[model samples]
Target: MAALSKSLLDAKKDKLPAQAAEGAHVHSSGAAQVEGDELWDKLPRTPADILRHAIKGAIRAFTLAYGARVTLAFLLRLLAVLRKKDTILGALLAAVRSQDGPRFGAFFGLFAFGWKLVSHSLREIRGIDDRWNDFVGGCVGGLAILAETPERRVSYMQQMSVRALQAIYASLHSRNLVSIPHGGAWLFALTGSQVMYAYMMRPETLPSDFYRFMVGAARVPDPILRYNCTNVRQGQVDPSIAVDLVRRYKGTADNLARAQGMSATPGVIPCAVIHPTSDSCAETNLSRWLRVFQMIAPVYASLNIVPMLTLRLKHFLTAPRTLASKAIFNTVRSSSFLASYVTIFQLCVCLHRNLHGWVERVFGRRMADSRALVFLFGFLNSAAILIEHPSRRVELGLYVLPKAVDSLFRIMVQRRLAVVIPHAEVAMFAAAMGAIMSFYQREPECMTPMMRKLMRPFFGRY
Candidate 1:
């Protein structure tokens, strides 16, 4: 009995050191974890620390935004060299040296600085952090738009307003408070109708760049469109103008003869005038679509790839195959959309010409080259928006909606139907930015994926 008791005591004593070491190890881990948390907490606990962090963040934002802007500019200039015949290396160098190139960076940095300064100051003053702080901070921060060119301030305002409105709608959508089934398609159709009508009848009312884009997409010489528009306005077609245009574009013999023989009475613009190079509208549309796709694919590819290479180098490096595949897919998709847009628009016009005789026979009246027919064809072509991915439809609609509104606004003002409000763009920008930041901090999930990706560089985590 005595030997057994001594053996048990020795066994218990042997376990004591191992248990002590294990407890010490756990305590050490706990201490390290607490220290790590303390380091994190130290970052924004004091005024000096907050200021240091904000400045550092602002600098980082500037670098990221500036680098992105410069990279995009270089790529665009390179495209210009290839497509638009811009001077090669000189244009690139000028892009780098351009004064406006750095303004985007300054805008981003100043906005970050202002947001941090205001939000943190509010927190300290109120002894609490809340959504209101973010709203106020964002409004104040948005004034940094002044850092951009006066012309760009309005563009920025319009884009941000659209995005903010989208965010707000998304937030409401989450709770089932509102919904718009197929809203993107409807919006695109509605806005696109106005845009195309303006392009045909009142090109001068459109923005210069947008006007140029339309001209290119239509694949028609500007002189022909201008001539046709004038005829429509004057309620008389001048065959001489069409003949001259066909001659200028090196139209086929049949087309040239057709243009020369057109009646002075009002008539629809001919397919020959729209696609002067080919006799058959169907063949021209098919070939032109292929050509446009080839031309536009490279531009969209650069747009997608350059941004990834510049901003997300780490991800690109980690999974080059995946990223490259995605970029290529997106490029093809976007290029297809643009190509289809052009093809469909021209096709609609050709179809209208083909069907006009049947309609006149049925109604016993000529359509008479009315602007209303042009508007109808324009509206019909918007069906091409369906070619794009459904997810991107709303984004595309939002993008074009502002341009349409701008055109309509100008038309209204010119006709004395509306008055311009001074500094309205500035006010709209501030308010929209406030709403954006509030949604960003409080419910980032409400923002579109692209918008969230865009804001992440400057705003960081919610």
Candidate 2:
């Protein structure tokens, strides 16, 4: 009987599936069962895997969307360069040739004529101030005759403001003007000077108080400029009123932060140009954030400036007006001020938004990762702001000054100013773009998830 039983058992063991045996062993002890279950849970499965996939998918989507936006900006700039290529190239060629020709002599003669036109126009414009008609007329006439052909086009918008006279001559007759056109001699010279002023002068050369006033005035919308002007004249006496103004502008920062999915911490200023004077208006978090921004700003600013220097040099040499060159110059020049202004303005606005929340009696939500993303978003938005500001008008005046003077001297001496403006502008733009890209790449992880999600719809699959 034992022999028969043993034979049956052997047969049953042989017939049993391998999986079944393994399962039996797995479930035999409580510890083993728990361990087995854990192992199974750790392994990828349909639902959890789907969730993980979704998150990754979202990130990819956002990245593509951001990339597209950047590309679009670049494309638009490229289009501008294409449209302006002739003017840009002509300017370069003129700069190079100015080093060795009678062109310098003609340019100086034109510069003097342009200066006279601008002075006469300024006196008339400043006196009237109300009749834009006359101002426009004079500007048009001056621009047409004061500047040389290519420089005139560069200063097409400014015409021949006296401030621009030097720059125009410097740009055109780097060495000397061998030839000067007869049709609009004065207008052309003035235009050249305008370009010089816009491209050469530094911030320190500007009237500090006037610049500050302009900064303040920019805050007042066009519709309210007159009303605010009156209010200032009357010496209106309400601290709360000023606070309200600050608060209103401050809302812009909150909107920006929310758009980026950053926490809108209460009573914290996101950015500001003017430092806070009153302790009553202070928020600790905002103060700290400002400090961090201030610390990093110099580093970024330095990086950005490096390219600007290169662009300046390049323009001095080649003077090409290709899409690449324009992009570099515009990006660097605009970004420099934009970075400073946005940092200050946003910080102020964030503070105001936070204070408003505090006033509303809501518990302030701390930013995830302490609002690290906010900093990055502010930085990016600054690029757009820099591009749009009216200060560019002033910058144009400054940028052209040194070059115009140099050109004037060369024309008088029959020697080259030995610098190229167009190539320099282009190089500056390229360097700025490269630096910005670097900054963005360093913080790829900080990009918001929503931005990623929006990108997904476009990429098809990632």
Candidate 3:
């Protein structure tokens, strides 16, 4: 019994050192974790060190911005070459000669430099770091927009304002402070009305790309658009305008006679004038939609395909077949949606023309080509938005809202209904930049997924 007791005591003594070593290991690991969790601003840094870091960050930002622009240009030009619109050498030259890349790089780089410097300096001054410092820093940084050409400043300001508003709404929604069912669809419809009106009545007010898109979708000669606008403003239809349309559509004079007889108010534009290409409105709309789908499919496909191939090469390589299939699917889906939009709008206009004739016949009064009718048709046509992907609806709504607002403001100013404030765009841009920066730092989840993704490389994730 004494020998057994001695053996147990010796075993217990050996276990004691093992337990002590395990405890020490755990404590050291815990201390290292705590150290690792320290906030960035809490780190010691001299003023000169901070400036050095800012400059380095700025260069990184510049490289990223410049690279992205060059990449996009190269891809687009390559597409043109593929279509035989340009040669390969021409495409390369176009990519190489992209003047806007340096400007974009400068704006982004300077903004990064200013943002880091100001935010870090404020923390040193106040001996505390908070989101407000980030906001102020962002505002100062946004002044780097001046690095862009004057023509681009207003455009950037408008885009930022829209994005800021969207971010605010997202934040409110996340907190349950705001809730509205089908709110995005409603917003799209409302803003879309203004956009359609501008497209018809004031195409000049729209951005160049938007105006060109409208022209292409309409598939009408410029003279026809001008004539239609004039007639709509006059609130009367002119049979005389049908002569040129009849010729353009390859219809005989007898077609105009048939149109006048079929139309209740001769002044109201006939179906032949609206869709002069085919006798059946339904058939015409179907063919137009199919044609647009075919035309845009390649464009959308390239847009998705190029980015995946170039920007996400690693991910693409890892799952080449799957990624390629998904990109193709998305391209088809987006093309279909855009085709539906254009066709639906045209169909709605044709419906409006018929409705105008019916109303005039019933009431025995001319109300054709009225602004009220135009606006009503525009609102009705926005229902095409229902066919778009649910996730994309809000994004599309936000995109068009700013343009609509710009058009409204322009119309108001033209009619002397509103006074223009000097440098209003500049002030708005600065304020919006501040809000955007604060959201980027303190409430990144409030930003759109695309916006957050674009910013992560520059700002770092929270």
Q: For residues 65-152, what per-residue lDDT tens digits would candidate 3 score against the true structure?
A: 7777776787767768878999988887888687888988898899888888887666456544457777888888889888887768
For 1-462, candidate 2 gives per-residue lDDT tens digits of 334434543453455333222322244246765654454333222333434543443344344433333333343334335568545455444434442223322333332233223322332333221223223322332332222354433332222232233333333444466334331223323433332222222222233443343344223222223223323234333333334444444534443333243222212322331222222323533454344444434433444333333323455356545634565555555445434443443444445454645634553334321233333433343333324334343333343344444345434444443544553322332233222222122221222222223212432211
Best by TM-score: 1
C-alpha-based local distance difference test score of model 2: 0.35
Cα error, candidate 2, residue 201 (Å)? 24
Q: Pairs clashing in candidate 3?
A: 237-267
- lDDT (CA) for every model shown? 0.77, 0.35, 0.73
Clashing pairs in 1: none
Clashes of 2: 89
Determine the backbone clash count of candidate 1: 0
- The alpha-carbon deviation from the true structure for residue 63 of candidate 1, after best TM-score superposition, in angstroms, is 0.8
Q: In model 1, state the lDDT of residue 218.
A: 66
